[model samples]
Target chain A: MFFNLKDFIAEQSEGETDWEIDLSPLLALMVTLIPVLLLQTSFATLKMIETTLPVLSDAEQKPEEKKKDEIDFNLSLFANKKSELVMELVVDNKRLKSVTIKPDGEKFDFIKLQEELFAVKKKYPKENRLKLMPGDGVPYDIIVKLIDSSRVTPEKKPMRFVSSTGENLETTFLFPDVVFGNITN
Target chain B: MSIVHDIVKKAQKDSGFTLQLTAMVDMFTIMIVFLLKSYDTSTLEVKNVDGLVLPSSITAAAPEEAMLMLVSKKGVFLNDKRLASIVDNKIEAKSLAKEDEDFIEPLFKELNIEAEKIEAIAKRNSTVKFKGTIFMQADKGLDYSVLRKVMYTATMAGYGDLRLAALDGEK
Candidate 1:
């Protein structure tokens, strides 16, 4: 292909002829790269979608076994299902912020929440130390949506948890000092 | 020498000033085609047991594995099985979840069971890892306590990677 185009151009110059330049080679290059370029973009797009964590495959199931390992992080969230679109945030046993979603609105003010999350992410970028304890009967989808919404780009969002209330429950899982000194009595 | 003839000759010799945009246009056309191809496959919607609605987010990622545990507003579920909903002898899943306390005992038990099952499978095959990704599909109105409890349970279950489900524009 290269030799043909070189010769064609040379011949035109030698003949001093006003012939139209054939762009077939350039078009061919583009046509060849179409699939490769398409594949690259699609791969990235697919990667982001894949991270949403779909269901597990068969070759991946294991039977239940008990192990005594402490939780890596203690994190949670609070959603007010009684009212419309109201939610609160906590991190490392501390109340971070409480923001409200519009009644019957499809979205929440994530920009404000992102600020709160940024503060927490700045404090604990690698490990999640927050807990998410949601109220009863709040739409399950809303809770999931909140978790998805709380994430910040280029930063790790805190972990979430359901609320618990019992004296038998222990708060010494992570940063025991924070549980006792700041989050608990 | 005629002034117009001299000027015309000089202008014709100045070839550097002219640019052929045909090549540029070709490059742009190829780039546009690639960009369109690389765009993500629209978006996907997933549901839990109770039909609780979760807003999907653009940040929600696709994973190599598809082991998602759905925590609905009603109770804790895996693939939609009721695992635990009681907190201190309570049946409600929406009540104020205890905060800063060990609030994930019941939920963790269920998740740990599932994790062990996966681990056992991985052990048998020796080709897969038991580490499945978790997508937390929490409601928008969930309180801090309940949210925390759910988060704690997922982390304790040996699922370190987490994805929060939300609508795209919301974030």
Candidate 2:
């Protein structure tokens, strides 16, 4: 029989074509990385609080004509390291009586601040802006807690308010817009 | 004895087993999908600095991509570079008042350079406007005064919009 080198080579090549590349190493890598990634992955959602430096606009400088029914309910909260909170209520650019609240033990009396804010909300339900002036020594956590306290009313009465996804919730609204003010001596 | 040997050989041949890999492949596919979905990489990547603990908040707004300023108990860093150190919860006097009044010099310089670059880009691309926004991640235990100075410095350097970074608090 004649030696058929071409036929032999063709058969060998055909056999080689049927074989698949080994994926065991790649599979091993995926297995290792998947678990590590899972361990490093965070389930907690990310959120943000938008703020702006106090910039006085020209329109703000020019005061509008005041009406009889209009009441300026601008409120400012001053927090100090001595666990003291001084809340000032301003009406039409005039400072009203200031209420000083001492802390209950170590923690700042957020409940008292809430009660005072709730009373202010009762008078001006449409007023949602608040100025938070934290002292130089006040910690960031307390400021965040104060902002949270100011954002919601203490009363659990059912009122109409929009949820995050545009759904209406039966909840009373409080001061949601916060303007961080300078700490004054 | 011959009959018993033949039966044993036939049983051995019948016992040749094959593994069913379809179930394993299905499980691996599900695991990969779940891991990919659970890992959220689409948001802005803010590197966690050492000795910095962020405050927790109930705000639902997601952070936008901007310049990063990390305020730790040790120092203040911008883009992983230390701008100034906090000595007794106060920035260096030179950085605070030497060149500019009340603004940190090093921070103002760095932020001004970045602002110029951003403004140049905005000028070239009409669609891109300079929002003058910056993201600040300060330590939870840091004094408000330090944060105030940082914010003031950023504002002076043309960063009007400030986004304070905080962890998501329990509802």
Fnat by candidate, in order:
0.24, 0.58
**After TM-score superposition, what is the CA distance of residue B45 in candidate 2 from its true location, in Å?**
3.4
Predictions in order: chain A TM-score = 0.33, 0.64
Query: Could you give candidate 1's per-residue lDDT for residues B51-108 as a string of tens digits?
Result: 3555554444453445555555566666666666644323354332465353456666
Residue lDDT tens for model 1, A1-185: 34698878888889876555544445555556566666545332222222211232447677656345422333444445553443444443566556564544544454455555545444454443334344555544554445544543323434343333222321112211111011111
| Residue ranges of candidate 1 with Cα displaced over 4 Å | A1-185, B1-45, B48-51, B56-59, B62-64, B86-101, B104-106
Reference-based lDDT, residue A84, model 2: 94
**Model 2, CA-based lDDT:** 0.75
TM-score of chain A of 1: 0.33
For each candidate in the order shown, give its overall lDDT on alpha carbons: 0.49, 0.75
Each candidate's interface RMSD: 12.4, 9.4
Give the alpha carbon lDDT tens digit for every residue of B23-82 in model 2.
555677788787877687644554567778878886436777887888998898887899
The DockQ for candidate 2, computed on C-alphas, is: 0.27
State in Å the error of residue B47, model 2: 2.3
RMSD of 1: 15.4
DockQ of each: 0.14, 0.27
